[model samples]
Target: MNTSDDDLLDRAFLALADPARRRIIARLSRGPATVNELAEPFAISKQAVSKHIQVLEQAQLVTRSRDAQRRPVHLDPARLEALTAWIDRYRLVREEQFRNLDAVLSEQAASRGRQTKDPS
Candidate 1:
């Protein structure tokens, strides 16, 4: 990955490191919500929730849009998708490696079986 991609992943992961910020993201995943709405379920103040929202905003994980008197925070699926894609790439690589290992083991077992049967 490029430096910019590394920086973005760093920011995104750091922002999600906090439980409150993670909860905020989870809530936004269900739908958009205002700062007040997000704070309602937390023990923290609305201001604290706003701070969490700011972190998410900086990470490009969430966005805010003006809706009349309210500025609602919405989850940015594109960024989430990017993260997922990065993870899936590594996961797929590991899976392929395991499949190759399994094939090798199976071949080795078959070779041993044939050798024993031939009694050479």
Candidate 2:
């Protein structure tokens, strides 16, 4: 990946590292919510929830849109999809490696069995 992509992933992972921010993202996943609504489930102050939202905004994980007097935070599905795709790439590679290893081990076992049967 290029430097910009690396930076984005860095920011996004850092933003998601916080439990409160993760919770905020989870809530936003269902739909958009105003800051007050996002703050409702948390014991933290609304300001704290706002700060968490700011982190998510910086990471490009969420966007806020003006809705009359309110700015509702919306989860950025594209960014989340990018993250998932990145993870899946590595996971697919690892799984393929494991499958190759299993095939090699099976071949070795079959070779040993043939050798024993040949009595040589």
Q: Quantify all predictions' global Cα lDDT against the true fold.
A: 0.88, 0.90
Choose the strongest candidate by lDDT.
2
lDDT of 1 by residue, 1-120 (tens): 243888888888889899999888888889999999999999999888888898888889998999899999999989888888999999999999999999999888877756545566
User: In candidate 2, what are the lDDT values of residues 1-120, reduced to their tens digit?
Assistant: 233988999989999899999998889889999999999988989999888998899889999999899999999989989899999999999999999999999888877755545565
Query: Candidate 2: which pairs clash?
Result: none
Query: Candidate 2: lDDT over CA atoms?
Result: 0.90
TM-score of each: 0.77, 0.80
Off by over 4 Å in 2: 1-3, 106-120
In candidate 2, how many Å is residue 17 off? 1.6
